[model samples]
Target: MESPSDAPASAPSGTTPGLMGPATILPRCATGIEGLDNILEGGIPRGNMVLVAGSVGTGKTTLSLEFLVRGAERGERSLFISVTEASSKLIQNLSTFEFFRRDLIEQGSLVFVDLPVIYDRLGLGEEELTGEEIDILIRTIRDLVRSLGAQRLVLDSLTSVCYRIRKDEQIRDFMLRLGQELNELGCTSLLVSEIGPNPARYSLHGVEEAIVDGVILLWNTRRFGDILRVVQIVKMRGTSHSRAQYVLELTPIGILMAPHLKGGREGGP
Candidate 1:
């Protein structure tokens, strides 16, 4: 893995000369959140699977939506795969945000697919995902990406999928394979997960952290009698990122994260 600074200053074509010599530096995919990209240096390593772990009300979905919306604004096709909510409901919820554009959806620049609907389409019932079932799911997602030419993807709430798998090894295998498939499709992805109250765990299962290229933890802390949303970059491979916990704010337009201030818990919206 090449550090951001070690990456090539310029690339002529297929193979770019870097500090590592004759290596290709993957481009960065901006998350579209204010100040967050700067903290990440430029953006996440392109085609890397990133885990966005947070408990409820931590603005996990909002942040993921903003990532896709921002990518769409940049003319990058984005796909949101929802395992927890219907497409209509998700769209309805995002309707209030200034970044939520119905025109993008209409234009097919942004797309939403419910996982349950895909399962039903494939004639698979609600049960533990076997090897065959997992393959089908991966194929379905890959097909979607290929068809839409998607550059960014968000699998909202991977925790929901983990619940259906019975064995820990199966979950690990599933995540590994899923990440590889997504990477092969040349898409930067966010695997959103609902973390438990335990701050030590990055995801529902401990397997997710090891499978992804990055892990971002979002949580709320009580500071001076106010609930302050905080974001921490636990790990990001191939790029140097700020590890400090920053203040996260949900504004009318989108999320704005700033460095934590001393005794200023009431500053964020």
Candidate 2:
């Protein structure tokens, strides 16, 4: 995890960076989104695993994919761990995004590990994954992360790993272990979660939220019978950020942020 006051990747001043190397500054990866990066104090701290939580259809996948693409554009190795989607279908779905680059996938700058391959071996259903299965799954995940030299990792949804074991205690332990392991690898990570009816809360009713370094909540507020979609940064350890929710839209250009420029002056808490 990055220290609370770690210099932003795009540090504003021209002062020498506090990197360990003699005059060699630390490398920072830029997330492609403009307003989102500003909210992150210039992007998620390098080498920390973050959790993005929301109900189904809450742009979790879209946000994560964009993070991977942003890192790839900056020449940082990236990897996506698909706990639910198939390798082919995963690629097919992301292929529709104009921001997604095929060469990045072909050249190994970005790679995806399909958990279903192992889940099928254990016979776990789509929503059911077991601790025994996860133990087996972790080995494969660890191997792939090393082989690809990935610096950015995304678990499409940690909820699969949570329910696989069928016990909340086991899920908590798994989340802690996963968070610790990801930190040791020095890879920036994002874990997705499916929220419940209480959309205002940041975490699911489990341990995934407790272990993550930061948490982002994607939102859709129904006001005056109108559905307004938004994304907000709820918790980011060691950094200061705007708690307001920014109106969000998905377009051919990519995900758009509606801040003050939109018809609303305020966002979310």
Candidate 3:
């Protein structure tokens, strides 16, 4: 978690301007995650790719699901592309949440795609993704976005894909192409990535941080004999965001985040 003091001054000079200057305010898409929008000064920039990187059990999946579910409630079509979990299992896990609605899925307002199913269809084996394989993956995503007219998208666990790509340059190229495709399709995306415990790096390959428009890091830290979950807006290009870490909680309703208070910690029951 970055301290608020670490953030670049919004008004560095009266004359000299910065990315957060008055003329550079980008359009925002409200995430509907409690306290998160407030921290982001409304929401993430529209059409921007955001990386939700974290270790296991840090609420990355829940957070992404809640984002799609909230968008569905607003009549915005959303697509969830799962690389690790099957669509059935994903839905089953999220079924207990109050925000989860069968009607949304039935209406096709919320759609899910299992990447492994696509992989099998393409006959891709357990090897590094060649240029052709990467192209196939990107095309599949593009076709889904167009067919559904998806306004928001979530790619759950890009870490799985990273494992299949052996080269750093290949991963970087894939991300660049994928980001461009999503932007052109006008879909705001959340790319979930699994990071290792106590990571000095925010992403699996250390390349995603540079490819996306924003990086939101989630992690757990032991404090006073209790494991505390924290959410931090590591970097949000062309947007003003809170640099301080916030305590995150996963409830029956959805995930909630709040500013971390001095000498106190917060977590789910």
Candidate 4:
């Protein structure tokens, strides 16, 4: 397997990566988030959705943000929808991450939406979506995607939508509709999911993992009084990726996936 940096710096014209190199499609944009795109073969398929699952403080949001912001840097507009968070609060929290800034969010390149407000105003129970409601919700999202011509998208925690709506059927139906909508609109989306503590059983019911084209699991463990982070390519549909769980770190530079196994916990205060 070629190192990410070693792969050809260009994206293929269309349809696939070098034909048989991997089952997953190579990324058109280098996420700017480290080691991730490598295990993902190149990156998540151009318009496909991926669920980034992990526990609290595991960096799922940060990674997703980096992915979207990186897209902006590449001249691709991006969108970030937080169903459970207020937009102002979400932006404030992200501002402290390595590569986040208000300037980017206000520049029309990285648009943020507070879905919690929308849902609250609608009084929509978890899983309470009727066919009619879904139609409107999708249309709104599509409007945002089209208006921005967004090439990348991030949903802070899609599974929470299940909790808020309290219905699996609705979640499933909405996701199916949303996924197709995103694909048709050419938005590469990262759906953040809060995983259980165990690294193996990261996703809640595996639906999120199953629905998307790829799944990246992030885990953290304490060793010698230091927190060590690890990321694994649980699955990627179109590319041949490294099966190993590599070390990851969140430093002043954002998320970094160290492929070399560097033998332990990353240093930071």
Order of candidate numbers by TM-score, starting with the best: 3, 1, 2, 4
- Measured against the true structure, the TM-scores of the candidates, in listed sequence, are 0.88, 0.81, 0.88, 0.81
| Residues 76-111, model 4: lDDT tens digits | 788999977777887777777767766777688788
lDDT of 1: 0.81
Cα lDDT tens digits for candidate 1, 1-269: 32222224443223334364424344677777757777776678788999999988998999999999888887889999999889899999899898789999999989999988888999978988887887788788888998889889999878998888778888888888888888887788999989765557787778889989999888877765988888888899866677877988988889988887756444321
The C-alpha stretches of model 3 lying farther than 4 A from their native spots are: 1-21, 264-269
Indicate the worst ten consecutive residues by lDDT in candidate 3.
1-10
User: What TM-score number comes out for model 2?
Assistant: 0.81
- Indicate which candidate wins on TM-score: 3
Clashes of each: 0, 3, 0, 13
Tens digit of per-residue lDDT, candidate 2, span 39-102: 6656666666788987777688888888888778777788988878876787888889898898
**Residue 68 lDDT in model 2?**
88
| Residue pairs that clash (backbone atoms under 3 angstroms), model 2 | 129-164, 130-164, 245-268
| TM-score quality measure for candidate 3 | 0.88
Least accurate 10 contiguous residues by lDDT in model 2:
12-21
Instruction: In candidate 1, list every pair of residues with a backbone clash.
Output: none
Measured on C-alpha atoms, candidate 4 has an lDDT of 0.70
